[model samples]
Target: MDDRLSGYPDPDFSLGTLARMGSSRLVTKAHSLLVTDARVWPAPDERLGDTVSILIVDGVIEQIGAGLQAPDDVPRLSAEGRVVTAGFWNCHVHFTGREWSSAATAPAESLQHALDDMLLSHGFTTVLDLSSNPRTTFALMRRIATGELRGPEILTAATGLTPWRGMPFYVKADVPWVLRWLMPAPATSIGARLTVAAQIRGGAKLTKLFTGSYVRPDQVKPMRLPVARAAVAAAHRRGSRVFAHPSNRPGTEVAVEAGVDALAHVPDETEGTETLLRQAAERGIRLVPTLHMFASTVTTDDGYLAPIRAALGGFIRAGGRVLFGTDVGYMADRETRGEYEAMRASGMSTADILRSLTTEPAEFLGRADTGSVAVGNRGDLTVLQTRDDPSPADLANIQATIRAGRAIFLRDSPSKHTADAP
Candidate 1:
């Protein structure tokens, strides 16, 4: 055993040891405040014209309107002409890496820096971690909920399900053997159901299925329909949604047959691609266009890129819901400009893009009180330092991210000392 592992009270323990080592930094919020003078988008479809005031009390939006005055005792922050919208959501992300698993045990500054760089700095107030070690992910969520950590609302899928021999070759070639425990492969339908139930019981709000996975550069393997169906049934019975990684047509068919709630990627735009996407949309299967993931991971030409763009455009035209996700942890590109550019090129309007980042995912997650800057909603917001009616590209100009009325990531500036100071 490594010297570090030997120091743990239980040398056999994994996440437990890491959690104990880093439990000292947990600190909860101790106050409330008001924010004024901001151009607020009250919802994806409604924008309150410039200069609105929002009252946040006990981590909820107490009131919102123009020319509202703050209470004498509460602290206030002035947005000073910035654009404020409902907190952004990255519906697809992964909490993989030493920094993430051991965040609780890391130095406060280091953890904060890592989190800001990965999610917060990008204005993601809520993120769905599609794959990660359940123990560490849940522990991190608990810390955030208790205000021990300044980060986003994390919904984890826990360990994702794959066929017994279906681990993607790309992943198998890279991931260490010990970390393979995070990706469970069940060979039988009963095993799949058991895996789903176990994950839900282990604090997972959602489940992930590798309906299709790449075995080699040209070969793709898909989970058996029975296994997929069983997992989906178990998840739905447990009141959780299921996301699927549809590697191609076969995988997509399995996902559609299983009635998965969301498709984790935009499949290859091959023959009948448009028809398949439209059919999936009709079935109410939402798509998370990790368009950037394809652009970054695989070597591609204009021909390949065009098909993906067309497929996504066709799905949107068919009235399919789209959610924002960049595949950040897995892809290594944290900045969202390329994604915005790709979506824009695909004929996605700025409103549609914004909805993907806010309303859509929140509603999908049953978080009606979030994804909007409405009274009584959670006071989660993303403030951007940009002109009014900013485009998707302007999203990169994030000024600060506020979760539950507290500023979790505030860009450094000479005059912005107090996050809640008016």
Candidate 2:
């Protein structure tokens, strides 16, 4: 976050009037949080078979074993034999929906509903919000960072950059002409570079480029090579990752040649994309297939989806890294079962999926303190109940979401949103 910024410009941005959203808040912020009787899956393949206790002090795990103790006044969560792992990360999402337009001053309950519907109930403790009103995004970041809201750790990009004169046709159609100006499509390399630098200075942690954009329902436009390269260079210099929304083969090619760090979505049009995808994999470029997004928003026909799914499988087979994400705010349906089923159908095993959700993102984003459960790591964990053996859907059975030892989501009491004590 931009440290120099004091607070939101909106004088009414925060009224500090939030009612606790749920009655299931088992812990209040105490600089320490304890989870008892948890079956810990510290990593994809490493699971502690027996129930154990996790003791967190000052938002860091201090101990993980039996009979750990804390002060009687400390907060506690009885995991009750549920599974616990590193907190889940949803790498692609948006906060542009109408419900979030007033995030800054809205009652915490109202904002919490949007979060639970889209993210929290699914066990996401961290998310990358690709595009949204920057003001709203910043306000949200401020609220979360200050513990004014109970939600995920959010990283966002500025208004995404597109090809010269190119804006997603679907978006243009839905919005009025004047609003189009807010959607940037710089024509010059210098302009693109400067835009990116400014966004980063304004608190954006990632750069989103529409290397391949749908300028029309029937046409896809790819950003110019020099412009794409310049933007990537600018972001890399700032230590921020560049994510691209490639609409087709040409877009994928630009993404690879220009050195984007990740593909936010698999290019939906697969006719001429395989070779470039292979090249992207060879370059160590990460992919968030978002397979279900195509099914949910475009079409569910096997004819339309089989090849896209095949592309993901091929990428994995080629050793490309995968990040688990559902295009939640954009796709609108919050259920994650279909996404898991689609990835599995594309040949990712349970462990593979787990890595996408946990370790893969942690490694790609260079967040060593997160992505795993350890004594010295951040106390961010997702605890879920499962049957004898866990399945993809079972992963969604969230018991609670803890970030830095504070409870953000409690499935048993989904309506709860307790602001952390300062």
Candidate 3:
């Protein structure tokens, strides 16, 4: 029997009907309408366009020419003086059923629902879930896919694949042990393949491998590499990509040689030379950078954060692609909104930052249809009420977050209008 239904009640609410009702916000005559008088960040490499009218229809854009007009029945939002861009994607995020570790032991369905609420409320309409037990994450994702729940489109990896010592030691043994219970008995040696199969079978879009160890207080250098070429090759055969969490030179070199697809975070403790950057570029591997997480983990010393920023700048200059990844909700001890602020403090330009949070991740995920505003794209978007212009602070304000054309999150919006569960 499927253990998934071992403990359940006839659900009090029909998620399908609720989701449909929530979607009605998008079912307007404005479906085929024009959004005029707004500053449009239309595409990568294009500066902000002058006040323009974007014609949208059936959740896709029909026209973006100047001076477009709205149809008679179509509702015309006074987009005047608002900054409009594509919906944001957090390439490196972890979604789970519990809050701040202190809350729950076993995964809770309500926890999943609440997380979906928070994510949509925060304007993250798409996320690549890098943390969580595969079963729990996918169970929630399947609901969203079936239109039974309103949440971001989810792309997930298996659980965090780390060697015994490299794994997070802080979590009580119960966490890893529960995951271990669900894993195969022959998993020790061939665990990567098993892990990959579990996630792929569960509909994961990618895989995560921890090829490095946590920073040890006494040790001068912390190094480890878990998954190897054979395992990565297996994932490739399964038509999925692997992202390696490599925080040291040896670990990074090994992951690159093994042909992993992305680096979850650039090593913050060490400065990467041009040689390594070139190798990564040649491999066509993208970097998530995840400067926010790095900054939070390490106390600032002279030049500690400097190299991170410089390395990112150099990578972009060297024609390397970058996707914005916040690594949010893994340990939500701190507020997640500060991620955007941290990036700005690191000297990233506003346009580049927005691209990382929006277009680039969409392209990386192969979900080009929902990321940008254009003809035939999904009507997922964000509207920011900026003060002066687009500043990092304004970006974090999150005036309104739209998922599938419905306002799931809005600053000062009515209580019932918001999706945040708490």
List residue ranges in candidate 3 displaced over 4 A: 1-37, 50-57, 63-80, 100-118, 146-149, 171-191, 215-226, 271-274, 300-303, 333-337, 387-389, 414-422
Q: lDDT, candidate 1, residue 245?
A: 92
Better of 1 and 2 by lDDT: 2
Clash count for candidate 2 is 3
CA RMSD per model (angstroms): 4.0, 6.3, 7.0
Pick by TM-score: 1 or 3, better one:
1
Best by lDDT: 2
Error of 3 at 236 (Å): 1.9
Residue 312's C-alpha lDDT in candidate 3?
68
- The whole-model lDDT of each prediction reads 0.79, 0.80, 0.60
- TM-score quality measure for candidate 3: 0.76
Give candidate 2 regions above 4 Å deviation: 1-30, 413-422
Q: What lDDT is reached at residue 231 by model 1?
A: 97
Which ten residues in a row are the worst by lDDT in model 2?
15-24
- Residue range 1-422, candidate 3, lDDT tens digits: 12222111112222232233232132222234445566776665666666777666655666776778766754444454677777777787765424412112334555444654557556677778775544445455555554445567667774656654454443223343433333222224366666566556545568777665453532222223344565577778888778877776766777788788888887664645556766787768888888767667565553687787777666677777777887775535334456676677656677777888888777766776876777678766766676245776566655655555544455564433323221
* Candidate 3 colliding pairs: none
Counted clashes in each candidate structure: 5, 3, 0
TM-score of each: 0.90, 0.90, 0.76
lDDT of 1 by residue, 130-162 (tens): 976555565677667566577887877876888
